[model samples]
Target: MAPGSSAFKEVVESHPKQMNHKTLKMKAESGTVKTSMSLAEKHSIHGVHELLQCPTCAGSMYPPIHQCPNGHTLCANCKIVHKCCPTCRFELGNIRCLALEKVAESMELPCRYQSLGCQDLFPYYDKAKHEKHCPFRPYTCPYASSECCVTGDIPFLVAHLKEDHSVDMHDGCTFNHRYVKSNPHEVENATWMLTVFNCFGRQFCLHFEAFLLGTAPAYMAFVRFMGEDSDARKFNYTLEVGAFGRKLMWQGVPRSIRDSHRKVRDSQDGLIIPRNLALYFSAGSGQELKLRVTGRIWKV
Candidate 1:
């Protein structure tokens, strides 16, 4: 046994089986072992095995890696350690592991709100953006009490409020068909009238609260309903324009007065008066309506 030659023979002669066993044990403990049956295989068995185990904890790995302050590779459990990097003392703000991020990106994730009709899939990084604008996001209409049941995206909501929940805004007089005057009595010259009809068939009469001036006009209106007192109830439905001379004349004679006649007429000609009748208009300046109605109305 010459010097180097004797050393090599000794190494070869040593228990090769023991050496292999030690190597396998070490690799297994590190979660890096794989069955290499051939030089090439269907999948990279070692890489696949490693993929299944966290490089930091040597435990079962989840796809996305939550990271710490210092760019230390960590398993989810270790990654959450006081928000400090496990490998260094870096203070973490909001760290994310690119390696795990890439893994998550390659995997398909369904929208969190998918059950609510959101049919979008997104990579890990884009998840927040998709969630922010998902069509299934829940929202409530601002004018919910005013017969507006519309609900949807912000733009849709705004359009619904403008087109459906809007009340007829009047820029001119609601009666006399004239532009509203600086004084309520001055409104007598204007013929335009304003009214709001609720879904419940109740009627409200509107009048100018202050003089019409500048671009917008000030307005005031009273909502009237049947009262307990007969006298009060007698004028219960009266929408008086006062000095403005704009009056909404409902069929003053109640059904009690015309019921007999109406019944006879219906028996003869089948004519009927609608139970709920109301009108809508703009008073002084801005005029718009949320619902359709009948009546010869105009804006002054």
Candidate 2:
């Protein structure tokens, strides 16, 4: 071979074209030198291109950057005539494009829900879509009713119930009993009688008990007493029968069989005995069944 050809042959032998091709193939397969620009670089280029586009006259735009209320970034030309965002008609505001600044700086973006589901990295603009469809989003209703058959998200269910089923909602002690007084006499004579056998001389107690169908947790037994015509004294008693009667022990009275009474000092149109008095049964008959009630009463 010629003298110059000899050096060229040596150089070619040392660094073969096949070796270079192999190295390039390995790099391509390993994805080290990507063919296309990265997502962040692409976003930066697009953002810059958009910044240069004129929104008002279809011409090129010039900075400083402004944003609409809907978060659309626009140039100064668009802000002159447009009090609102050109794209969404939202009100415009003076805002900086820190995101574009960040993109220009080459900061790495993360996948939305990286703390929830995903660990993969992504461009900042792609994060919104990822988070919108995240699988682990937590949801709960604010109004959860334990007693009724209603169950749903609180705000929606509360508004629905208020509008459509307002009458169904009631406020009171859930433990109290509701009854219509059929016999006024039974109610009037409630304070003095040992046992109110009838209401208005009618058997309303028996009917009330039967109407309850044994489902009530407690029984309400009203009793009345007749006093001589010295002064018309009235009494009302509401005996809480059954296990619930045990609560009366806190009132310094035997929850089982207790005696209590009040005397009428002044004449106030006869004594008006309050209802809701509790009574306990004595061991035997003729036990002097005292009235354990609260209210003024004249002693005969």
Q: Name the top TM-score candidate.
A: 1
Query: What does candidate 2's lDDT look like per residue over 1-300, in tens digits?
Result: 111111111000011112121110001011122224577775975676455455556653333656765667666666777888878877777776566445433433333334543444433344345545433222121111223344332234435545643312222111122222222223221121111121221111100111111332221222112111111122232323222344231111111000011111111112222222212321123222222222111112
Q: TM-score of the candidate numbered 2?
A: 0.19
Candidate 1 positional error at 300, Å: 29
- What is the Cα-based lDDT of residue 3 in candidate 2? 13
The stretch of ten residues in a row with the least summed lDDT in candidate 2 is: 250-259
Instruction: Give the residue spans of candidate 1 off by over 4 A.
Output: 1-66, 69-96, 144-300
- lDDT value, residue 69 of candidate 1: 54
What is the clash count for each candidate, in the order shown? Answer: 26, 10
Residue range with the least summed lDDT across 10 consecutive positions in model 1: 6-15
How far off is residue 111 in model 1, in Å? 1.4
| Quality of model 1 by C-alpha lDDT | 0.33
Q: 107-143, model 1: which lDDT tens digit per residue?
A: 4344556555554445434555666654455444433
